[model samples]
Target: MIKTIGFGIGLVRFANAACTSGDGLEGVCRTRRECARIGGTGSGRCVNGIAVCCVVQKYCGDVTTSNSTYFANPNFPNLYNGGTICTFTIRKLSDDICQARIDFIAFTLAQPDANGLCATDGLTITGGASTVPTICGDNAGQHIYVDFNGNSTIQLNIFTGIAANSRVWNFKVSQIGCDCPTRAPSGCLMYYTTLMGTVRSFNYGTTGNAAMTRQLANQNYGVCIAMQPGYCSINWAQTAGDLYSFTVTGDSPTAVTTGTAGTNAVIGALCTTDFVVIPNPTFTGATPGAANVDRFCGNAFQPLTTNSKPFVLTVVNDANEVGDIGNRGFSLDFTQQRCNNVPVIG
Candidate 1:
């Protein structure tokens, strides 16, 4: 019995009295009757105790127009048994909103197949300018940025298999206005704005036999980092200790090493299947014989620094994962360096 829930956006008025709930979530101040009509719960008192602070939550089959809405599974945090389809649509809070960010607070579905395809279970997002890959598995801490310029509504469709595996998913969607300075670029799947932060592949953090086929297939998108004021260069270093830290290619997780700590550029043949692109890369202290040292792929990562403005990293994956069985994905740390004016390319 597959229950189909269609989620879409509609025109809804904003709450006149915005307030914060007891658990630190944003809510609107409303009367008890108004709150219950929209299936919201009264978390606390608001409007100087004259109204209830209502925390609005949308479940399967519900369409929400409110900003910062929590779109979750029915009885979220609890696993929903297989054989169900949940869909939801989110409309722009206003016409000026340009982007929406979906943060996976708690997402767990059936793992992808051997070919890195979401055959059994998957979640697909539509109505965005950028193409997003269908994803499954434990992606609790990941987030996606969708550009919604020409369209006012975005839809989320979740399909679960008939198998006995239980699934759980909970995410929050926050709208970003066009004028917002921190908005993500047009085609970036993920965006970071801080001076230093970590960027990991989807479904990262698993290891060994259990991690085989964790990487998503048919993915081609940018992971952008906003340039901070006065920062002239950025340094990228893969997280140490995990052998599969940079394993986008190779037979086994440790079968390939493209270059020695960014000493040489990666060849084109090795990156034919999947690769991460560092555009116009520059390194300190050594000059290689190659003209371009931009693309990176393989089981090893070479630490490199670049002065590329509007810092961006592009990740591309092919349609199939035939030889990518043991690839666990990548986790990289990026730090923006302040302008020292000593010439970055020594």
Candidate 2:
């Protein structure tokens, strides 16, 4: 799925030749003087090692159309205390570009309300194919894939209303060409490419105060994992000692289970509202009917192995939180296993 590359904002100003920076960020080929004029940092070389690889970065109130651009809150690296809205607009570098990938290198904002709503502070995306939930709290290292679907521009707005907490955010926005191999499949809000990685719910991090409810409500999206070649199965395990992980509550008297056998394993219809769908879950050392458990909720996730092709994990959360359940959400570790290939002899 290779697509022709396109240049980003002010394509006429920067050289058309693509290059990479020393820190491995994507950039455009520009002379040192041109790079300096645009406030880009120059590293590495392009155009037969003669032109500089100029990495462009934008801040709040800036509009960018460049590929592989970095945008951050004003006075980034330092906390932003202003209680206001900061926005960055992204225009397609070219018509061939069909998606935007936003990586949150560092994100911290005022916490959501008790009901898991981003009422106080949040990050919102406007004009993309997918509905990105308004997110707040600590989401550093999280990333999102947005589909352009012919929209000419996209906007990222960070809203800070309360003044107490110091806010900071740094993000890298990369435009994805249509049919790009790295582009996420349509409808996957979050995508993973590595053979092994951790998938945490948005704002899945430490809560400084007890009043905060870590789980965000009304979240329903697919978290897709790119199936690495030669790998046929993926194993999911709960992060050890992370108590808040997998705290999606169920109806009372159903009682959350710890992956134990018998009626203890909550699966399928047993998980009514909030549950993670792990298709065709296979429990290691399982008892009767234990392997049948697919949808999991009620506070714990056991080690699960599955051979589901295309590797998609669906997270479904309803609108409201159960009373005093303290639903903190999930943190899961996944590793794809290689398939065994046997030699055929004549």
Candidate 3:
């Protein structure tokens, strides 16, 4: 896969002098002055400045190789008479691990005149469809397509009113590739746990305690929780002595249950009485099945107590399989406070 080798940073400052050559424009717009403002080093530099000119060249590579050129001026109705150049590099860390499968490269730009308004446009790679401009509500950006199949070079361009000084662009390169194995799996149901308060003791049925239970629940893609145990009990603080008030979070169709704490069980230990939830197990893919649990514990939720809480669960496949075979395993740890209220569980 394409890993970042390095990035080139360049800066340009606007010229101090005002534009003198005005063909018909009204404002104090000067091609020379504007060019200087873009931090051009010499005369005859493009109007937007050298940075744009240079990036375009770098992205396009040799002019003889690609039919593209930078826009001569910002005032033309034909904004992009000749193509502009954009360039960047990607490095491959391993020869056999993965290869770059980049779909496209996105470029975000700042608004014109700082009224907080922005716009976006996209350029095609090979023979893809052109993307429409998205109004970024005072902050717009653009995306340019690139072919990263075997090459790491990116080339494309856009036209805009963004001044070089006030202009800002961000690049995001996306790819789907395999990762090399970094370690061997542990035999125990690989407990990928995240705790909030503290792991003090392993008692069950106490005030301010939490626990997690799993059952043979069947979900659309996988299975849902068959039964949630501690939920009903948690609400009892508001409705004193009401057994009906006890609610488990939700039930799984396949019905997963908790086993007693031991070597094979998924257990939770608390350092204090303030409830602490054990981290939810992660899977490697969208669906949970025999293959999903192959690398981790499958038969039990070990540490069940009033102090264990289950937040979010995710599954990720192995790092080296083709298609979706490598996509098994719960790779995400969603116990952090910020991930608690997501609408989807996967």
Candidate 4:
């Protein structure tokens, strides 16, 4: 909550009259109210020698990005040419004092070049310069803080030298107060898995193949998950199999399935299976996008199990092949939580 208190010139005279008991001692008073009465406001009255003052109050609202700017290299399409810096100023509308946390979401769309491409290789900003505080790698966004210091405005900066055409970039700024606990930095643990099978020609478009089956374990709160087709990159043998169905089960052991076989079957007969699954993944706000991999394909469930704890994550890939030989494969990576030497508050 926010509140403002003050009085105008006329109210000062009224206050002085009440304080002086209507003795006409206005000119001898030092308070602004006294001066107003002596200045000829005859309406001044002393009601029980008490004075009234004006006060105003207002509610605090959401924080907003009040200003944003992008700075590019002066000599684009030339040596050492690219975006140099980006800055944002966020403001909160409130009469009360509050603090805010700022986070920069950056994406690159530039093509790969000898300069190792403008990959989101962690929050480097610039190569070999200085690492950004609270850096969370390239694909994922980085979190920063801006103390209002009881002031009306705050600013944040994101300096970069990445080639301008690599990926798309976006940012989100949120106001955090004492009510929320600060998040801890954790390391990522990646796991790999594989499956194999065979398919018949009839399983093509005419009738979906039920032979292929895939299942992933439920996720934990504060965690995120993603999946992608594997083994497609290599020149592995391909086949026209029946329906390609993938099922994912949550804590309740219920199954959710999607995909079609034959024409819809994953293009590669044998490809690497990739999925991003993390328990208790923290997000700055609502509708946070998947950071490292493709979007989620199965049912979205709470990251925590019924017991209110992290759940064991599992992925099952199933595929079928015809002719003399057939094979299916997959892999997974799990990120582990890491502790940093962050300062503790009393």
Best by TM-score: 1
State the C-alpha lDDT per candidate.
0.78, 0.77, 0.23, 0.26
Record all residue pairs in model 2 with backbone atoms less than 3 Å apart, i.e. clashing: 8-65, 8-66, 9-65, 9-66
The digit string of per-residue lDDT tens for model 3 on 194-279 reads 23222111111112111121101111111111113223101001122322111122221122223221222222231111111223
Q: Which tens-of-lDDT digit does each residue in 1-346 have in candidate 2?
A: 1122234642233345677799877788877776787678888987655578989889988888777789988877888885888899999988899999999988988776767777778999999997888888889999999998789999999988857787888888989989789999999999999989999988776443355467777788889999887788899877766655566664322343334322333567778877898888787534433546678876666677889887888888777664625566778899988887933222
Sequence-dependent TM-score of model 1: 0.85
Stretches off by above 4 angstroms in model 3 are 1-85, 89-108, 111-159, 162-165, 170-177, 181-346
TM-score on alpha carbons, each prediction: 0.85, 0.83, 0.20, 0.26
Candidate 4 per-residue lDDT, tens place, 56-142, comes to 111112223221112212232222223554333445555442445433334322321121122322122211111222121132233
Summed backbone clashes in each candidate are 4, 4, 80, 60
Error of 1 at 303 (Å): 0.3
Rank ordering of all candidates by TM-score, starting from the highest: 1, 2, 4, 3
- What is the lDDT for 210 in model 3? 12
Per-residue lDDT for 345 in model 4? 29
**Candidate 4, position 274, lDDT:** 22
The per-prediction CA RMSD against the true structure, in angstroms, equals 7.8, 5.8, 20.9, 21.3
The TM-score between candidate 3 and the true structure equals 0.20
Ten-residue stretch with the least lDDT total in model 4: 53-62
Off by over 4 Å in 1: 1-20, 23-38, 46-52, 208-211, 254-269, 284-290, 341-346
User: Residue 86 lDDT in model 4?
Assistant: 39
